[model samples]
Target: MSSLTPGVSRLSQPPTTAALTARSSTPVAERAAQVRFRRAISLMAMTLVAPGTAQLVAGNRRVGLVAFRTYLGILALGAVMVVAVALDHGLALGLAVNTTLLFWLNLALIGAAIGWAALFFDAWRIGQPLSYSMGHRRVAVGLNGVLALGVAGVLLFSAHIVSVQRDFILATFGDGAASDATHGRYNVLLAGGDSGAGRWGLRTDSLTVASIDEQTGKTVLIGLPRNMANFPFAEGSIMAEQFPDGFDCDDCMLNGVSTWAQDNPTLFEGSDHPGMDATVMAVEGITGLEINYWAMVNLEGFKELVDAVGGVTLDVKDDIPIGLPGDEVTGTIEAGTRKLDGFETLWYARARYGSDDYSRMARQKCVMNAMLQQVSPASAVKNFQGIAKATSDMVETSIPASEVDTFLDLGMKAKSQQVATVSLVPPLINTAEPDIALVHRTIRAAIDKSEGKQPAQTTKKAEAGSKAKADTGTDAPPTSTTSTTGGSVGSMKDGYAANESEDLATAC
Candidate 1:
């Protein structure tokens, strides 16, 4: 409406940018309302940085005091955790593997999330948002929601991560007394399981004992050929009781020891996995090293694990076959330095189409070494869920839940150390009639050499050369030649190049 009085001007307010922005005609009541609205917004924002501050200044002082104290306590706890971790780097690993503690931590996170969201809501209420203009009120609500949900969402996600770790630990490790280190060493049996390590009617496709120093983390991977025959059993063990002289039965091989024991369950009456027990006994008898724990991997699961890590990098020496010698070819992983996917990696480790058992064993060591070095802690964390799922699927272990942190630490340390391998195959220790005394001395010598206790034994003199001469030997390494028997780089008469390596990394 136009002004009727003389010299009257416009009645409507100017644009928002012009209103009260260096103005002289603005009303006191309207300006006061604006000030209160600004004050309300300021209080809400204070709660975002310092929870309960808004309530302390304007609403409930007691509630604000409680929330503020709780917040301070949490901050102090976090600081303490940081200091503890600084002192002991393995402290977080302990917490991660501890299922009981993880359960509590996850619950605490959930509770903290709820409490934090509640405090944000309280701050919004204390802002007196209803008294503000509708637009201001909407802004206040939106900002309050962002703060509340943002913190809660982060904490909720943390809780979920904790839950995943707890589940993986619980599922993988069993409740048992942790095996103490033997002579300052932890010897764990690594095998490929057709069924599972702890189940009935199982046979190991591959076997390697990962003997590690408890203090230095130096490791020796002793690869036992699956076809090893006529081996003695550890004294006083059930296998020894059955075959006092030696396991010299017709067609009896090293891998069949498990199946043989499982057939006569009465011998291992109280044992869940008689086959595994027998295999461990045989391994102990052969190596003279005490076995602490065992881990078995399913081939299918092994592929998944490799895939989970994005793939394993390998020095593919030749065109590795994918299927058995007699079977039609499924695929081939060509020679040269290549990063192979899960399927390709699995074949690289297991393919025996043209390769002999010993050659395959050599390749197995290569894969193990690659995994130990390349699949890093960072990668594990980055692909945490995939790795966890793959690990649980493919691997079965006898390691106690308590010892997980110890192995986790040891594995990390092992990456920094030189990994050596000893394979009891042709040209070193004959599989058909292996010199039992020589085998023991060879293994001990390897371990001793690794520990700087003794000098390395020469290939001609030693029964099982500690050096991987078969795979990466001086004579033109394994390549596509007439001498290349099967798919591997060496002939059947001599042995596979990978059968033994002084440093597995160099051999592969």
Candidate 2:
């Protein structure tokens, strides 16, 4: 009312003490906000660097201590595993294959992930993010949520993968210790079985003994014709006792032994795998080497395994037929170097049209060599899940889970070495009546050659034939002759038919 001086009015007065206090406090509020933003950032960083540190410093001590200890233990275990893997791969594999250990480890991973996520949430609470300015608070929440989910999600996913692998191993392998290697080698009998309609049990079509050196992993494959007859069983085996005079029945062949044993289960009583056991005895008697373990690959299932590894590449030597017996020919696999799918590979290995069993055996050996050489470690790791599924579905083995690591190591070593093969076919040994003593001597010599103790001994016919071809400067006409050693000579040009050579690759 007294504001008649100049332009002054009662409504327009200067700032009072309270209003000034508020104005001056604006800078202080801004400074507080800045400090809070920094604190929020630092707390999140602490949680990231070392989970539960904020809880230890400002929140619940018990939860913080537990989480911190667990984190430290996990780090320690990871470091120890890295060191162990670097020092001894077999030790790492052993731990991986141990189902009990894998189960506990998977559980620990899940638990740790949950505990770590809880610690992150507690850390955010300890930071008092809600007390901060809106911008700072939002940033803090976002970061905390991200970190919690990220750490927990990754660990949970890894746990799932480990669980899958553990289940696969547990389901696939039986409980037993690894068999002992004999004569500085482990002889694994690899048989390919066909389960067609009306085929009683599994009719083993391919028989090969992979003799692997215990130390160097140098391997020799000894292929036996499925038609071989009049063979004795391993001296102390049940089959040997039953047929002391040898498997000499008029209609009984080597491959028939498995079916006969299955039909007459009482003959192989107390044996869990009577068919495979009987076949193992026949193989042992024929090869004259102890069979440490046996694996039968279902040929139909083998296709899946091949496809799982992304198909195998091989040099096809001849046009192979692809069709069932007594069925119309679907197609023919043209001869060339090509990558083959599961179906094509199966046909390539099992085709009997325009070929005999001996030639098929040679082709199978080539397939085995190609697989061993071509499946690289990188490719295997990339396709681990598919390969695991295929192997579990296709293969039936007596090899135990505990021995997986040792065999894995040996397989890796074997990959670096050359594979030698010896097939006892028509020109080498008569399948009608195999010379048991001569078979033992030949197998021993092949093993010695593989170990570098002896030279490769080519047959006289092969030597003479090669010399005649060289002398003539043209292909020698095919001829057959009965030898004094009870073997029949045949053409070597026809895809290693009834021929034995030091190098299977060149022989075929």
Q: Candidate 2: RMSD over Cα atoms?
A: 5.2
lDDT of 1 by residue, 97-210 (tens): 989999999999999899889888887776677765788778878888988899999999999988988888888887779989999999999889665456523778999999
Pairs of residues clashing in candidate 2: none
Best by TM-score: 1
TM-score of each: 0.86, 0.84
Error of 1 at 478 (Å): 14
Write model 2 residue lDDT over 1-508, tens digit each, in one string. Answer: 5545777785578878999999999899888878877876776677778887777877788877877787788789889989989998788778878899999989988997888788788777777776677887888888889999999999998898788789778776767667899978999999888866765236888889999998988889998889998899998988898899999998899888888888888876777778999999899888888898988887888899899888988777667778757888999888788999999988988887766777678678878877888899899877788888888777778889888787888898988887887777756677888888777777777788878885455444455678888999876665433211111123423325223545555443
Error of 1 at 440 (Å): 0.7
Which ranges of candidate 1 are over 4 A from the true structure?
1-41, 195-201, 455-460, 463-492
lDDT of each: 0.82, 0.79
Q: Cα deviation in Å at residue 47, candidate 2?
A: 2.8
Clashing pairs in 1: 325-353, 354-486, 354-487, 468-500, 468-501, 468-502, 470-497, 471-497, 471-498
Total clashes, candidate 2?
0
